[model samples]
Target chain A: MSIVGEIIISALLLVGAGFMLVGSLGLARLADPLQRLHGPTKATTVGIGAILMASMLYQFVGHDKISFHEFLIALFLFITAPISAHLLAKAYLHMNRTDRE
Target chain B: MISIALAVSAAAISFSVVLNLWRLLVGPTPTDRLLALDTMVINSIALIILFGMSYATFIYFEAALLFAMVAFVATISFCKYLLRGNVIE
Candidate 1:
């Protein structure tokens, strides 16, 4: 890769790292449990995704090897995260319903 | 090329984390927090994969896979606990 490209890649990685840090910080700092949850789900997700993509790109361009595992992981995450979240929410709602009765 | 892709994806993941964080901070119920935690774990798995690529090693990928499996089980247990007030019940 060209020096310019390397510089750009590094810059992007730094930005992604910053995002992850910020997200984690928010998660730790948020007051309520509900509020704390948002930080990792949104900001941290993007941060981690960017970093993973960068890794894949690096391997593809620099090493000239086919890479698909990360994609698979991404797919798995996209599918499962929502489902788990839904289940948890449902359970919480169920608990609340029982409590109110 | 791979580096660029990794960088972009990382940035995208970061955006996702921020959005989830917003939801967590403003959530009105405990369920919302739990949901966010689930999301975070998924994101972390992705991050581990990226780190593996960055380091040019397969260990990170293995770790990620393990995390994914464990996370699923953990979520199930937590959800069960939430519903029945006991993990085994």
Candidate 2:
């Protein structure tokens, strides 16, 4: 791979990893589940999205064939994350709807 | 350099998974546990794809895709149970 492509891939991997780290930190340290939910939903999506882009780009630069499957995973995650997050929130409220916070 | 980067990212992601597991184990509420489980699924998916990238294989790609689908279904069913007290009613 060329130096520029290498740089981009490395950057994506590092940044994605960093986001994942931060998101997990939030999950562990935060006091509330609702607040903690923010971390995994947004950061994981963007983080993994970046990693997927890096993978697709790496394959494009390093291999002869084009691959769209990486994007397929990203798209699936993007669509699912919000739906799961929303439903999780609803379930949480269904149990604790009387509490004021 | 690529290998080094892959190793570092893999380590970081694994640490993140460990943390997610911590939340899963010690979450005060069932909802919190489910949230952690959902997040863990995404983390594993990312790690699996990262593995695919480093190993230069296409088969892990299929596993990653299928895993996502199954995890999504599992999350929905678990949430349904939480909301309705039954999954298939």
Off by over 4 Å in 1: A93-101, B1-54, B85-89
Interface RMSD of 1: 6.0
TM-score of each: 0.66, 0.96
lDDT of each residue in B1-89, candidate 2, tens digit only? 77888899999999999998999999888888887887788889889988888899967888988999999999989999989989997
- DockQ top scorer: 2
lDDT by residue for model 2 (A2-100), tens: 999899999999999889888887888899878988988898889889888889988998885688998999999999999999999898888887455
Best by lDDT: 2
| lDDT of model number 1 | 0.65
lDDT tens string, model 1, B1-89?
54665666566666656766765676667676566666666666756666666567866776786787788778878888888779874
Error of 1 at A64 (Å): 1.0
- Lowest lDDT 10-residue stretch of candidate 2 chain B: B34-43
